[model samples]
Target: MPRPKRPGEAQDVGAFPPAEAGITVVDWIDERTSLSPGIRWMLFRKVPKGINWAYTLGSATLFAFLAQAVTGVFLAMYYRPDAAGGAYESIRYITDDAFLGQFVRGMHKWGASVMIILIFLHMARVFFYGAYKYPRELTWIIGVVLLILTLVMGFTGYLLPFDQRAYWATIVGVNINGTGPFVGPFLSDFLRAGPEFGATTLSRFYAIHMLLVPGAIGALIGAHLYLVSKLGITAPPWLKAEPEPELLEHSEV
Candidate 1:
C-alpha cells in the first residue's frame, strides 16, 4: 500500500518524470512479460491452433501492393504520359530503350489484378467468419476504403500506357463522371483538367496515377494496418478450444 505523506515528509517519486512515465511503464511491462525463443507473447494469449485459408489473403494483398509499388516506380522512370503522339514513342522507348521495362510493366499490371482478387477474398473470409463484429467494425470500414483505393489505382493506371485503349477508356470514364447528379460535372471537369481530353487530361491523369493516388492509398493502408494491430486478429466464430488428450490421461493417472 502507498503511504499517506506526513506534513513534512518527502513524497514518494516515480522512477521517472511524468513526461518520461513511459520508461516506468516499460519497466512494469518488462516484469510481467517474457520472451520465448525470440518471440514476445502477450499475457493471457493462447495461440490459435487452427485457422482457415481466408486468413492468408490479407498477407497476399499486402505482397501484391508492394509488388505494384516497386514496378510502378520503375515504369515511371521511363514513362511519358502525353496526349500528343509522343505517348506511343515514349512507351516504345520504355520497351526498347529501358532495361527490363516490359517485365516491370507486366508485373505492375498483373500485380494490381492480384491485389484486387486478394482483397476480395479477404473480405469474403471476414464476412463468412463474422470477423467484422463488435470491436472489428472499424477494420471492416478501413477495408472498404482500401477496396475503393484499389479500384482508383486501376483507373489511374489505365491511362499510363497512353494507347488507343487508354484514350477511349479515359473518354468513357470522364463521360460517366460528367453524368453525375450534382457535382458530377465539376468532378469530371476537375479530373480531366479540361472540357475535352487533350494535353491537360494526360498531365492530370499522370500526376494522379503516379503521385496523388499512390499517396492516398499509402495513407489509408497505414491506417488500416495500425487499426488491425490495435484490434488483434479475429479467429473464426465457430472455433472452440480443444483439450490435449495426452495431458488429460496424465492428469487421470
Candidate 2:
C-alpha cells in the first residue's frame, strides 16, 4: 500500500490542512472500528424538551467522581497502609513535607464529600423528574448500588490514615455493620481489632478501599450509564404532556 515518494515531496504523512486533520484522523479510526456512531449516539442523542441545568446533575456527579479518582491515584503514591505508626507518619509526611501533597490530599479529602453530595443531588433530580419509571427502573437501582459502594469507599478509605479518629470511627462503623443478621458477628470480628492487631485490619480496609470497592463501583457505573443511554432521558415532571399533532383531527382535509 505504499506509494513511492517523489523528490521534493513532504515526508510528513499526516500533514493535511489543519481544518481537515481532525476529521481525517477520526475517519481513519472510525473506518477501522466503526466507533464513531456509537460515541455519537451515546453523547449527542436527543433529550426531552424540558432539559435544563438540573438534567446535568448526573454529569456533574460523574465529574466529581473523576476528580476523586485522579486525586486518589496521586495520594496513593505516598500513602502507607501500615498500622504501626507508619500509616499516620506517611500521612503526616504528605501533609507537611511532600511537594503539593497537602493540596492533593485535601482535594481527595474534600472531593469525597463533594462526590457524595453530587450523587445524592443527582438521585434527587432523577426521583423528582420521574426518570426512574418503567424500563429505567434498573438504571435507578444500579445508581442506588453505586451510592452504597461510594459510601463504602469513603468509609474504608477513612481508616487508611490509621489516626485515632479513623480508628475509633472504623470501630463504630464496623459495629454498625456487624448488626447484619447472620453474618453480623463474623463481619464485626473481621473489621474490629485491638491496637496491636490493627495491621491486618488496616490492610483489609486498604485493599477494599483502593481495589475491591472501587472496581465494583466502576463496573456498576458503566452499567448505569449504559442503561441511561439505552433508555434515554425523560421529560421533567413539570413539563405538560402535549398531544401529538398527528393525533389531531382536521376539520377539512
Candidate 3:
C-alpha cells in the first residue's frame, strides 16, 4: 500500500496552491485564446531611460476613469430616469435609505470632477512632454475625443438628481449648446429629445450617461492604450533625441 500523506501535504494529486492554481487557470485561457504573448507585449515593455513620474499622469487618469465606472454602476442600481418626480425621489432614497448609498453617490458625484481634472492634467503632461507628435498624433486626437466624451458624461450625469438646480442648469446647458452656430440648435434639440425637455428627455440622458458614452469611452481607451503600448513612450522633453546618421558622420569628420 502507498504510505499515507502528511497533514501538510495536499490530499490529491490535482490539488494546487492558490498561486499555482491561478497560474494554471491563466495558462489554460492563454492557450485557448493565444493571449499570453499579446498581454506580455502590452504590459512588459522596454521603455526609454529617464522616464519620470509625470508620465504616470496617463495612468492616473485611467484609474480615475475606472473608479468612475465602478461608482457609476453602483449608483445605477438605485437610480431612476423619471423626469417627473421619481428621479429626485430615487436620489433621495439612495441618500437616506439604501445601505452606503450616500457614500457611493458621493463617490460618483465628486469622482466626476476628479476624473475631469486628471484627464486635463494628463493631456497637459502629454503636450508639455512633446509626446503628442508624429506616431502619437492619433493617440492625442483620441485623447481629445475622450476628453469631450468625459465632459458629456459629466453633463448628462449632472441632471440625474432632477432637482430644481439640475433642471434649470440643464435648461441653461441645452441653450448654450444651441448657440453652437449652425448645428447648435439642432444638436440641442436632439439632446432635449425635441423642442423641449419632453417625457423621454431624462430617460434619453440616462441611457446616454450609463450606456452610450461609457461604451464609447471604453472602446477608445482600449485603442489609446494599444497605441501607447505599441509605439512606446517618448522620453522627457528635456532629454536630447538620438542624432541623425548624417549629423554623426559630419561631426566625426
Candidate 4:
C-alpha cells in the first residue's frame, strides 16, 4: 500500500460512477429544459393542516384508474374487437396463452370497480364536509362529470367480451337508451349502429372504451387537479371559525 492516506484523502474512482453520472445528466437536462421548477412546484405544494384520512380517497381513485389504463392497454394488444364471435375466443387465448394476461385482465376489471367505489366515497367525503360549497362548486361539478365518464367507461367496456351476458346486457342497455323520448331512437341507433348489435357496435364500444372515455377522463382529471392546486385542499369544518395565518413572505431575488 502507498503511504497511509490522510483522513479526507480521495479514494480511487470506479469506471462508472452512477450517482454522479445521474446528477450530471439531470443537471444538463434541467439547464436546457427548465423542468425542475415546475416539477418542484407540483411535488412540494403545501396542503392545509387539517387534512386527514378522508382526503386520501381521491388519490386512491386516481391510482386505481392508472392501474386500469395500464392493464387495459396490455389487454387491448391481444383483444379482437371487430369480430363478435372471435371476442370470447380471443379472451380465452389471452387467459391461456399470453404471459401475465389473466393477471392484467383481472386487475383491469377489479380496478374499475375499485375506482368507482373510491370516487363515490371521495364525493361523499367532500359532500359531508361541505367542501363542495362556495368556491369549490366548479370542482364538484367537474368531479360529477368525471364520475359519469367513469361509469360510461365501465358500461362500454362491459361488452368487449362479447359473451352471452355481455350481449344481452348490451341489448338491454341499447333498448334503455332508445326509451329517452325525443333522442331515444337516435341514441339507440348510434350505440347499436343499427337495430341490432353488430361489428360496428363492437368497434364503437371498443373505441369509446379505449380512446374516448379515457381521453375525456384524463382531460377532466388534469382540470380537476389544477383547480385543486389553485384552491387548495378545503379545511375541515372545525377549522372554519379559527383565523388563518398570514401568507409567508418571500425575499426578492
Task: Give TM-scores for every candidate, taking all chains together and pairing residue i with residue i.
Answer: 0.75, 0.88, 0.89, 0.87
lDDT of each: 0.79, 0.86, 0.91, 0.87
Q: Residues 107-173, candidate 4, lDDT per residue (tens digit)?
A: 9888888999999999999999898988989999999999999999989999998888888998998
TM-score of 1: 0.75
Tens digits of per-residue lDDT, candidate 2, 1-253, equal 3366789986666644687778879899899999978888899988889789988889898888889889888888999888878999999999999999999999999989999999999999998888899989999999999999999998998888788899988888887887899988787777655433355889888888888888898898889888888889998888898877776665343
Clashing residue pairs in candidate 2 (N, C-alpha, C atoms within 3 angstroms): none
**Pairs with steric clashes in candidate 1:** none
**Total backbone clashes of candidate 2, pairs 3 or more residues apart or in separate chains:** 0
Question: How far does residue 220 in candidate 4 sit from its true spot (Å)?
Answer: 1.2
Best by lDDT: 3
The better candidate by TM-score, 2 or 3, is 3
What is the Cα-based lDDT of residue 225 in candidate 1? 73
Q: Arrange candidates by TM-score, highest first: which order?
A: 3, 2, 4, 1
**lDDT per residue, candidate 3, 20-130, as tens digits?**
778888889988999988889998999987898888889998998999999988888899898889999999999999999999998888888889998999998998888
